[model samples]
Target: MTFQVARMNEQESAAWLGLVTVCQLLPAALDSQLKQDSGMTHFEFSVLSVLRFAPDHTLRMTALAETTSSTLPRLSHVCSRLEKRGLTDRFPCPEDGRATNVRLTPEGRNALVRAMPGHIDTARRLVVDALTPEQLDALAQVTAVIRGQLDDGRPARGNPFA
Candidate 1:
């Protein structure tokens, strides 16, 4: 396949650039705040949080990866780091010898307890507080549409460049 530059004017190109910038920048901003204040990267925090909410404070490693939208290798690496920190433990699954389960350690729970309020505050300040009720609803709708399109194996609507 060959690609060619579209005939977008300078203003349209600038807007596209801005969209890409925000997508990259927002996560970095959140991660910086999270690391400085909580000593956890966003991905680490997400993994810990999901485990924290699992039944019996444990989940199959594969299930954890699915919930976190992470690949198995990536999640395994993160789990290894957390294990080294004494925040989690992995054991063979009770019913399936081929599978492993990850559980939050007491220390991990403590860390998450300490970190959640700050994370929630940052999220509220950066996103929730800035949006009106209607904007939030619209944002949800837009994202859901995109997600549904991807899930349905179809091209998304409304954005030609998507």
Candidate 2:
């Protein structure tokens, strides 16, 4: 027997649209909230959080940019802003004079301490509270699938090549 192809109905269309909406909207919402509540943009928050986990709360600028998925120029601009706020320190790397290192200053740590609670609350409100346990598990699995495909030289399941 041959399979009959059918077009997606309105409900299917709505679900597809909703998934896109959540993906796009949630980050913007979180960024706005973080900026309003903590004076930190989400990108800036990511940089700070990454540095927080590094040894002595420092990382080479190139490494920091990579970890944050940012370009050096963009990271440098953010670093400059953070520096103005006295939240970070930038110095030439002692081990490699040609490289630069960024470190979280005491004030930066304090800012992160204050901002984290609000950021967590916002994340919960926008994401965690909205997902069921089953959905969360599914999402994790789906994300892994996508990442695996990216790493394994395979197209994702939906792609014709895969």
Cα lDDT of all candidates, in order?
Answer: 0.83, 0.84
TM-score of each: 0.81, 0.80
Q: Model 2 over residues 58-153: C-alpha lDDT tens digits? A: 999998886776799999999999999999999999999999999999999899889888888887777778999998898779767756865576
Identify the candidate with maximal lDDT.
2
Worst 10-residue stretch by lDDT in candidate 1? 153-162
> Candidate 2: how large is its RMSD?
7.5
Candidate number achieving the greatest TM-score relative to the actual structure: 1
79-141: candidate 1 lDDT, tens digit per residue = 999999989999999999999999999999998889888888888888788999998898778
Q: List the residue pairs that clash in candidate 2.
A: none
Off by over 4 Å in 1: 1-19, 153-162
